[model samples]
Target: MRLTRHTDYALRILLQAAVEPERRLSIAEVAEAQGIARNHAMKLVNELAGAGLLATVRGRGGGFALGRPAGEIGIGEVVRLTEPDLRPADCENCALSPGCGLTPMLSGAVRAFLAELDRFTLADAAKGTRVPLLIPT
Candidate 1:
């Protein structure tokens, strides 16, 4: 199954923040860097902050930064929080819901995917591309 755009954006935001742990990034900057809409970035930042993955500072010279250490936040945990539902298929209202085995198979696949993600954390994800972004902090 494919991840939603919202989750994709959320991950991007987390990665940027994690890469620069000392600097708080504004939504506008994140939006510009990720080529996403400002409003969308704003919403996702709020969600991330609410989920405790990001910490926000209000007023002038304020923005968002990682709330917890990148190594402490698992990729799987982020996926779980960003994704509203993990169901592989919509079987609740399907005519063949009772007999369809596709649901279970898909569910198993999703579970496996998440389990694999659990092995990695934001720190792991950042290590590959963060060298250039590091601010020496």
Candidate 2:
């Protein structure tokens, strides 16, 4: 399944945090690194923080960090959280919606896709990667 840009950015943000676990990162840094808008990054960061995937701090010298270890964060979990809809096909609007075998097949495909992603964690994706993923401010 093709992921939405939102999910893609969210995953990038998580990977950035995973890569720099020791340092708190700002939305501007994430936006610059991911080539996304600052406001978009801020919204995604806030959503992630609300989900307990990221920890945010306020006031001067404030930033964000991974709420838990990278290894503890599942790639599938992130996708599920960020993806508003997982249905592969719009079978509901099809003329054959009443008895369409494709619907079940598509649903199974989505489940399989998620299951494969569930096998990997943020640490797994960030493994062997350096801080070069993020641009210096």
Best by TM-score: 2
**Per-residue alpha-carbon lDDT of model 1 for 1-137, expressed as tens digits?**
78889889899999999888878888877788777899999999999899999999998888999999999999999999999988877889899989997888888898899999999999999996643333221
Task: Return the clash pairs for model 2, or none.
Answer: none
lDDT of 2 at 106: 92
Q: After superposition, how far is residue 29 of candidate 2 from its true place, in Å?
A: 1.3
How much does each candidate deviate from the true structure in C-alpha RMSD?
2.9, 1.4
TM-scores, each model vs. reference: 0.90, 0.94
Give the top-scoring candidate (lDDT): 2
Model 1 worst lDDT run, 10 consecutive residues: 128-137
TM-score of 2: 0.94
lDDT of 2 by residue, 1-137 (tens): 89999999999888889989988998998898679999999999999999999999987788999999999999999999999999988888899999988888898999999999999999999998665455545
- Extract clashing residue pairs from model 1: none
